[model samples]
Structures are given as C-alpha cells and as structure tokens.
Target: MNLETIQANARSSLGDALKSISVQGVAEHSGKAYGIVALMYHRLALCEMLADVRVDRFQVLLCKSALVRIHLMRLAASGKAAHPLTTCASQNFSFVDAITAGQLDLAVELARLTSDRHEPRSEYEDDFLLHRFMQKRLLHLHAGEDHDFQSLMDRWERIVEGEHAPYFDVCRALLQRDGEGFHDALLAVIEERGRLFRQKDVYPEDARRTDGALFMNGLALLRLAELNGMPTQREYPNIPHFARLPVSKLPLPLDSWMRPEEGLPV
Candidate 1:
C-alpha cells in the first residue's frame, strides 16, 4: 500500500484503540500489561512512519506516548498488577516526547523514579530496567547527565544472563542503536516467534499473537535511519516514504539493502 493509505490506516487503528481501552473514560479494561506496552511501541513505530511522510505529524505521534501512560494510569486505578510502565507514579511521568520537547528536568525525575530502589524479586524488574535504560539515554543526550549505561546493562545481566541471552543482546543492540546487531537480533526473535498467523486464520483466537508485521516495520525504519546516517539520537528520526511500508515481505540481510526510493530490483 502507498504511504498515504498506510497512514490513514494507522490513524484509524489508533482511534479504535483509544475508544476500546478507555471504557467509561477511565481506560480500565482487561488486557495484559505487556500488551499495553506493545501498543505504545507500535504507536512509536507509526510515529516513525509519520515522520517519513510528514514531519509536521510528529507532534501527534509524540502525544500518543502520553496516551499510553494515561491508559496505564487507568489500568492502575483498576488495581492491575504493577509493571514498570504501570507503576503508580511512573505512569504519570514524562516519556520520550517529553524529553524531546525540552522538558529535561521532569524527564530526569521520571527516569529516577523508574530506576531507583527496586527489589530484586519484582517480576517486572527487567521491564523497569528497560525503561531506565531508555530514560537514562534520553537524559544523557538531552541533559548531558552522566548516567552509567553499564549499570543498566549490569542489571539486565542479572536477569537475562542465560537462556534469556538472546533478549539481552537484542535489547542492548536496540537501545544502543546498533543497527546491524539489532537487525540480526530481531531476526532471531522473529524466527523463534515463528508464524503467529497462518493463511485463513480468524480473529480473537488468531489475534493473541504479537504483530510481527508492525515489529518488523519498526525495525525496517530503524535500519533505514542507520543507513541514512540517522542513528536515532536525541533528535527525531525519519526515513523516505518508500521505506516506511510494513516489511512483512521484506528480504533479509537488511544491512545491505538497496535504496528503497530507487525501487528494489525484482
């Protein structure tokens, strides 16, 4: 599909999502915490697409992150178990857009709240660690704070040491914007996840699996940014319109991809 069609679909999806989750305007509903974060992640992916299509739509995409937190807040109000994003106050704290918008101090405080004084036994420790890394990187870039990136890695090491080793590598590469490493790690992840949807698969029963299309789309955009000399720094990242399509059928060896704007050779 063309970029305009894809963006229109994204807009409709976001609207339906907001209406479904925000029942009675409380944003209370039954869904996994992982699912919520995944939704926010997908919105960020769409934001990347929007950036490619029109830089002006960036403000809209940035606002979606706050909506994710608001949804989490309503979930907390319903006594949903606390994950990193679902924490009582952290849910209300500033996120990526806030930092980009020059709200550095609030962003730093929020990162502190996410990272400090966590019990080892918390089921969501790794989740919190990931957010800590994201926030710390934002702070380091925007505020020039001296937050130790290694400390964050150490925390992940404690949790993701063996068996979870792949995740450890993937998350590290992703946060560090190691495009080639991330491309490899993400392929491994998708391979292990396998096909969530088969031909003629139906809804609800078939919808429980993660949306690999969206995830791959995000990765494709990231790779494009890296190739175009934009390695996801403090500034917003973008790609050409042709590169923003869902990559469900995109070939592998993404690091060596030919220019999408020039049309890949058949």
Candidate 2:
C-alpha cells in the first residue's frame, strides 16, 4: 500500500475504535476508560515529533489519533452517573491526579479490566502498524547525515513499501544547525499539540494523568538537549528562563517596590 493508503487505513481503524466505545459506558468506567486515552495521547505526541520530517502530513495523523482519544474519553465520562458496574460512591477516583502522581502502572491495570473484551481485530492490527511506522520514522530522524537523506528515504521505503519518511533527514541535519533553536521548535510543536488535545477534550478533567506524563517527558527531552548542548532554547521553549532580566536591578525593599512613587520622580 502507499503512504496515503496506510494513513487512510489508520484513520478508518481509529474511527471504528471510537464507534465501538459507548459514551455512557465510558463515563461510568472513567478509571478504566483512560488507558486508551493515555496511549492515544502518547501516539499523538510521537506523530507531532515525526511531523517535523514530513514525507506526508503528520498533522493529519495526529488529528486522527487525537479524535479517537477524545471520543473514547468523552464516552467514558458520560456514563459515570448512570452505570452501576461499580458503585462505590464514597471512593473518589481522580484520573488526572493519579496520572500526575505517576500511577500509570495502576492506570494500565485498570484499563485492562475496563477495555472491551472483544477487541476489534483490524483495529488492533492497525494500531500495531501505526506504532511500528512511527518508531521507524523516529529512528530515521535520529540517524541524521550518517546516511544520506535520499539513501535513508530509500531504506525507509523498503521497510514500508507504501510509506515515505516525511522529510527524510532534513530535520535531523537541521538539529545540528542550532541545537537550542531546534529544541525550542520541538517544544513549540508539543505545546501546539497540547492545545489541540485540550480543544478536543480528549481526556477527562479529573484524569489528567496523561497530561502530567507528557509534561514530564517533554522536560526530560529538553534536559537531554541541554546535556548535549543541542540548544537549550531550541529544546525547551516552553520552559521559562531562570535568567530573565528583572524589572529593576536595584534590590529595593518590598514596601518601596510596592509603592508606585517610591522609586519614581513624583
């Protein structure tokens, strides 16, 4: 199949997955419903990173993945009040807090229990292929100029006959241009993706565990960029600068600082 064909298949698979997840059921089982959301979020982040290379439009892929995640999470949250699968009213389940607290291991376990017993075979296969394609693209981006861009594209084509490695090695080579700038671009891309996630309401407000993970992971990547001196600003534009110039160099007393006329000619 060609790149378009593969993307179409992936999109169709995600659509089907959304259709299978009932909103009422999802709301009732919010705790368990979030596993898929977390996974899809991770996939979207990957797509955004790979999108910088651009053989095809990674934005489209990211959108499709995000759509599926939102639908599933909404469906789960909608079912919360009506479903009686588990009625422990006294117990509080905060999905967002759990994730932020680094409870993914538990989240996964719950997700397994809540996931559809009869998995859609085609969707499963499609998900696997999507992940594999993303991983391959990532490897290519990381490979840089050791292999010529054309040669890398050719190799990628051989690995997946129908697909292309978006921009080949262009982005990889550019990373060397100004590491900080590249890192900043990456952060900007991630922030853009995060906005999309919020707009779609893909995750339950109470279950923002995935959001925390994304932030933490992004931080780690920025740190790596810094360690390599890849370019701190490029790597972490979302992170504020600790060395920002203060409004004034003078260490004025708090009372003086607060008084509008204290340091100004009245």
Per TM-score, the best of the predicted structures is 1
lDDT, candidate 1, at 41: 36
| TM-score of every candidate | 0.45, 0.28
55-157: candidate 1 lDDT, tens digit per residue:
2333233333433444454454566654543452223333544343233443455554443545455435665565565566656654577877787798779
Q: Where's the lowest-lDDT run of ten residues in candidate 2?
A: 87-96
Cα-lDDT of candidate 2: 0.33
lDDT (Cα, tens digit) per residue for candidate 2, span 29-134: 4433333333343333333333233312222222222233333334555564323222111111222112222333222222222332223432333223222222
Can you list the residue pairs that collide in candidate 1?
Answer: none
State which candidate has the highest lDDT.
1
At residue 203, candidate 2 shows an lDDT of 62
